[model samples]
Target chain A: MTANRPLILLTNDDGIHAEGIRYLTIAMEHVGEYWVVAPEAEQSAVGHSITLYDPIKAHEISKNGSFYGYGISGTPADSVKLAIHSLLPRVPDLVISGINNGANVGINVLYSGTVSAATEAAILGVPAMAVSLAQKKNPPFQWVVPHVERLALWLLKFGLPPGVALNVNIPAIPPEALRGYKLTRQRLAKMRESFEEREDPRGNRYYWLSGEVPIEESDDSLDATALNDGFVSITPLFYDLTAHSHLQDLATALKNLT
Target chain B: MTANRPLILLTNDDGIHAEGIRYLTIAMEHVGEYWVVAPEAEQSAVGHSITLYDPIKAHEISKNGSFYGYGISGTPADSVKLAIHSLLPRVPDLVISGINNGANVGINVLYSGTVSAATEAAILGVPAMAVSLAQKKNPPFQWVVPHVERLALWLLKFGLPPGVALNVNIPAIPPEALRGYKLTRQRLAKMRESFEEREDPRGNRYYWLSGEVPIEESDDSLDATALNDGFVSITPLFYDLTAHSHLQDLATALKNLT
Candidate 1:
């Protein structure tokens, strides 16, 4: 609600204390007055979920400077909901979610808390972006800050079209190794998620979820493909889940049921 | 993969023992040979999330008669994934998620584990449907069974287009009171979620999540609108999240950054 500068609201799937959101808050500070409201715990794969049956508590956490924020014990979407509707005094100019620990690309975005936060903001009519670094190891987020800052400035300067948000995935390499940006599509490929069944002390079996990130080579048209080749990938995502093409066929088929 | 009848795999967000899935199993049995793989506990709003960080355990739960199933300690999407990839002896011809305890309409579907389960199956190239009863109170699921059976039969016979699924919501009224069906669009309304801040016995503060569902009157083309008018609402849903219309505009806007 700052009249002096454009207000930016920040959130992440990683807990509020995670290095990702901390760095994101720093990067966004240079462009606009920002606030951080994120999950109190890691909510990595908890997609656009909200806490309907449980209590969602928010406690304000002190940051050193002008950055004010709260940590909510709920999913990433709940953090955004409480921040926008209850915590903040005024509506935000832009909502930026993450410098996520891992890349949100391809079909993985469907299950991404990082992307879901941005999508929730877009549904509420605010322009938003979800930024992630494509590294499972220690991501050089310091190197990625400049790109985030640039994108934030660009988004603020030119507001996105209605019902759209940018899903940006940066290569994990150092700044010098970056090959610039690629405006790409969210690809159809998915991670090969497999489970390992293990027996606990009681001889009962439990399954541990594990998956291999896709390493298949893809063309520049795909976000994962561009990121794999050391390019930053920005994909325009929407909240409308309708398969517009299938509408006609479905309508026709359902008519036969009558 | 049964030759005599179509094979339908059923799952729900309301856990394996919910009356919704039980009714769904009964309806599907008349149409096809079916199996249930669902969450052991209620996982409403868990979206398309998979169990990546935790160990998931599956134990067989026997329902008297041919309704044999497995209950998994995971989200609805995880149940579908485990069933299709590991548990099921053969790939099912169709996947039906829910007959959910509550309606999943408009933007709420984005946070729905019920819809997410079906979306997961569609991602893997199986025809899928998410059936929900549009009542917050005790839903008359028996009245909705014929509608479910008819739709399941139609979908199996004609087959859904690739990457598409039907999100069906039936009225809570008696079968005769039902006003027939309407193939509608996913509306653009959302639940207004609010958190009630409370203090624990130790003086620690916590917030409970609750919300007022949107009651705004929408046009007949909307799923919420149709359901409100006592009509069965069927929305064609897809897994592609791209805002295809805004791609050109966004690409042109971000071109200056390069």
Candidate 2:
């Protein structure tokens, strides 16, 4: 098992000490040598933010005098970028972000620092994957290790195509309760967002953002639908945001402006 | 002129009083009635981060005894979300973000708070646009006004397709130096990154992230190409990240695992 292990770079939106990344690193330990570079704080919905305005400090943490990980004072994407460019001894064969505490699905993926870490790696021409256990809170770590290990190994063996990254969401149920897995699309729906307004003692007003419910898409091909059906949903995502189909019509519409 | 004017919602990654957004509002004044909801401080490169852990305070500021805008103590995306959810009188007919001080092109859009604000508005089902005056430093605001006005008027007349947004980047040139506008794709290339290491007085080390020359995509239809050609680049972007063509192959690749 040690003869031909692929080098893996592991990161997460959750800080280096989160149970999710701890389990992910443990599960990955048998598969390959891993380098943990993650945020020092929870960066849940930070999206693809990078640190350009300020200096980033990477503090090396250790357990029992062995190399543990780097605690980066930045976002998830920053951790990955800093690792690949400055921290790692060499380029990793694969980059895995998460085994996140809660799921990242639907239009919510746009705000996910978990997915952004993997997406950042892919942007730098590395094979990347983002894994999340679907639940509002922490999923059972013991139940999630195998699912993460299997996919991490699979991705290493069968490399992803250029410009693509795998977004994997697993059901929170035990491994035995998992029905199967399916390749899916990002859903079209988003949070039915609302805010709670409050007045301060000084008569100033403030508000808190709240997502009461998700407006789910019913299509079976969507990640939301498959995850809801108790299946591991693997969605192949890319960074190309161009709506290719509309280019011609939009060009026609803007022709008169020139 | 105000009769039946389109109701516009204007926001920016730069604080409300940034000259870029100020010029944007001034240019947009004649076209429609607009509501400004922008970050209170520079939120450059924050991407799509939303404030979930803390309460957001929005202070309404008035100019010359009239309503100016809401100064939000959050990221660009948070301001847009808060405005739509709690501040705006009703759903805005259109949303426009930026007139950003720098170019948000190539693969760098992933880290752009300017583009994220517009993308957030589109996710909430409004027609939105993100406009940038491309430069390393502030571009001449006086020269950018007409470009902003013409496009704003054009979009108000011809609504954008659902879930789609226009990421517009104008070259840093006098209005007369402009060559025209082209519909383009986001480039595939990214920054060649490096880190500059420095030590504090206490001997603690830190690194500042820096980007060297861009690894440019040479395609003629790309945003980088258009901008380099002195043309305004209008890239039609969306949040759906699915790599549709790879879905079938990935499904086949993962068949043995289940």
Candidate 3:
């Protein structure tokens, strides 16, 4: 590896002013020269969306240039695409998305903009990692930062396989109580659907979408299972959605249709 | 299967007013009892996004009692969630998303709202299908609807496996010129990224994200590859994003960290 410092591109779904990004920036301060580009508003569940119809406005937010940061009026995926395609000084060595609020475990990853930003980078042939706290509220970043920093350094040193990005979720407990990191697969925990019907001021009916997350307590060492057990979960995620095992059966089924 | 009509919930990424959804509604009228709840505006490329922080507005747009449709002020995934949670009579027997204006093939499926809607239904243990045309401009749905109807009927007769959704991309060409369907995998197609910089009336600089899709030709029979060969592609997509092959390697890599 070159002696030169790596160029790290940082982004998140919780908006530019989120506490998670601030803590994440502080953690990466000593490791490499980094640039931060994130959405201006919270885009939490906006999974892999790119803003195509609207013009993107990117405003420089950093004053002293300690970390060149820009707040963009777009989705998390849009920020990553814009930063890598137009803003960065070359392709970044690494892309880190989030110190996100709440755990992106199991089926939640499919709806996570935090992981989507990292996935976008990985699809473009960059090494990427997405980190999340296992709570809805702010967790103790002091303990989480060191683990993230250590993982970042290791990734920079060893390098990740192409087309794969790590989805890391840290438990929201004290360092002493935490069980460290465990590499796991995505579990099947899903948010149960609940809608609240309400009448708007204009006398029109509207519905608010809300849900409760069901606990998945299978014996498998999946991300949700690990996080539920108070263990930090790290899952390697891929962009390939093809169900390879079912290809033959699907082919046979289509043959009958023809 | 019950002698009663199957309840089919319909939605799309192109909003409730798009021609694609209208055509799909007409086609579905013959097959089952239908209910439509879609976004109020186009929500293309929005993958699996659900509106969590904002209050959603769902308004009934259709007066015809035979066809019930609601226009939602949220993403496609949100519409699906709202419909299932509050709008539908019960859990829908099947969910059909899109006759989207353009094809959602290969890795593009990762960023597609059309496919994500189907993925949401599949995740909820319902049979689902996401259909799209290979055209960019105003597509001729007359030719495409027959194939869609046939496929939809076949799927209803022989249900899909749980947790799997079929992503069908029909060639834009006439039905006569089209070859039979091919059960394919997701291919990696290169979309060139370039920004168009322009000054607004206020002299503020902004960018429009623009890119060209490169011709993707792969030996493996993937969705995009099949489309390029003038064949209809039927890819069985799953919501599981875990890279199963890399789990062991990641486990070994993180063993010491714990």
In the order shown, the candidates' DockQ scores are 0.70, 0.81, 0.74
Give me the candidate number with maximum TM-score: 2
lDDT by residue (tens digit), candidate 1, B56-161? 8888888666547999999999998888877887889999998787889988889899999999998878899999997767888888788889988888788887
Q: Which stretches of candidate 3 lie over 4 Å from their true place?
A: A63-67, B63-68, B201-203, B255-258
lDDT of 2 by residue, A55-121 (tens): 9999998867988899999999989888988889878889989878778888878889999998998
Compare the candidates by lDDT and give the number of the best one.
2
| Candidate 1 residue spans exceeding 4 A from truth | A1-3, A63-68, A211-217, B64-67, B191-193, B196-205, B209-211, B215-217
Cα-based lDDT at residue B86, candidate 3: 87
Q: fnat, candidate 3?
A: 0.81
TM-score for each model: 0.94, 0.97, 0.96
How many residue pairs clash (N, CA or C atoms closer than 3 angstroms) in each of the candidate models, in the order given?
1, 0, 0
For model 1, the docking class works out as medium
Q: Compose the digit string of candidate 1's lDDT tens values, residues A41-65.
A: 8999998898888878888887676
Per-residue lDDT of candidate 3, residues B211-242 (tens digit): 65755577658788888788888899888888
Q: Report the Cα RMSD per candidate.
A: 2.2, 1.8, 1.9
What's the CA error at residue A115 for candidate 3, in Å? 0.7
lDDT of 2 by residue, B160-216 (tens): 889898999989987777889999999977788888888989887788988657976
Candidate 1 chain B has its poorest 10 consecutive residues by lDDT at: B209-218
Best by DockQ: 2
TM-score of chain A of each: 0.93, 0.95, 0.94
- Report how far off residue A202 is in candidate 3 (Å): 4.3
